[model samples]
Target: MKELEERIRREGAILSETVLKVDSFLNHQVDTELALATGREFARVFEGEKITKVLTIEASGIQFAMAAGIALGVPFVYAKKKKAVTQSDKVYVAPVHSFTRGETYQVSVDQRYLNAGDRVLIVDDFLATGAALVGLVDIVEESGAELVGVGCIIEKSFQEGRGLLEAKGVRIHSLARIAAMKPGEVQFIEESGNRQLIEERA
Candidate 1:
């Protein structure tokens, strides 16, 4: 965790007053060492929960989710951004609005990958407006799977993402939580419990 905190402080770029961009190592560019550590940390947190599968959205969430699945020795399932030819017809879908891309999209997964008796752990790279996670959670619930928890690499604490998930009684675990981000500076929130802060700005 210390290494992750240090990496964010060093390589992460504060894009304005809110967004902390880690594209150089996280969101875009891949950093395997850190990614593995992040996954391991997530596994450590939810180790004894009897997680049968890890659920995540496509693109960014896949990397960490895969790593976590490897560490936990569980299969990981990712919801596709769009329907593909290879996708199974029997699926569960959820619509999500992405604030960053200014678009709304649906993420879907094969119903066979998840079921009513499954215990799922949702993992993602970032938690901004909570839209992506919300959609993923919806899909999991549709399959009647028990959502054990949510694991995020970088959480924008100011966005009300955690509050939204907590209201549903889901436990949230983030390796790095940005408490505040200002022009040329970013602060990581170290405390837990319900507290609202600014997540991003133009």
Candidate 2:
């Protein structure tokens, strides 16, 4: 996690509208070492939880989610960005607005992937407006799956994502939390709790 935080500080690009572009190492080009380390960190953080499956939305979430699933020894399921033609009738769907693209779209997963008794951990590369995260949570609820927690690599703390999830009684573990980002500069929040742990490593 320390390494991740450092990477964000050193290499992360802050695009317009609160978007943190980590395409060099994440979000676009794959960094297997860092991705695997992130997965192991997530597994370590949520070790005691009875996680049956690792759930994540498709696109950016797939790499980190798959890495975490591998480390947790569980199957990883990705919700499609849109309803696929082969999607089953028994599926959970949610309409999510993309803050980055300025568009609304649907994401879904097969009902068979999640069930009433299963424990799920949602993983993703970043947390911005929390719209996608909310949609993922909705899918979990629709399938009657227990959402144990959410794990994210980089979270923009200035956004409402963390607050939204916390209001829903969901615990979020973000490796790096950017309090603010300006041109050529990024600030990480220094809260006394987990934030301190992240800062200590920095």
> What lDDT does the true structure give each of the candidates?
0.86, 0.86
lDDT at position 164, candidate 2: 86
Which TM-score value belongs to model 2?
A: 0.92
Candidate 2 wrong stretches, greater than 4 Å: 191-202
Task: State the local distance difference test value for candidate 2.
Answer: 0.86
lDDT of 2 by residue, 24-80 (tens): 999889889999999999999999998999999988899999999999999999999
Question: After TM-score superposition, what is the CA distance of residue 74 in candidate 1 from its true location, in Å?
Answer: 0.9
Scored by lDDT, model 1 comes in at 0.86
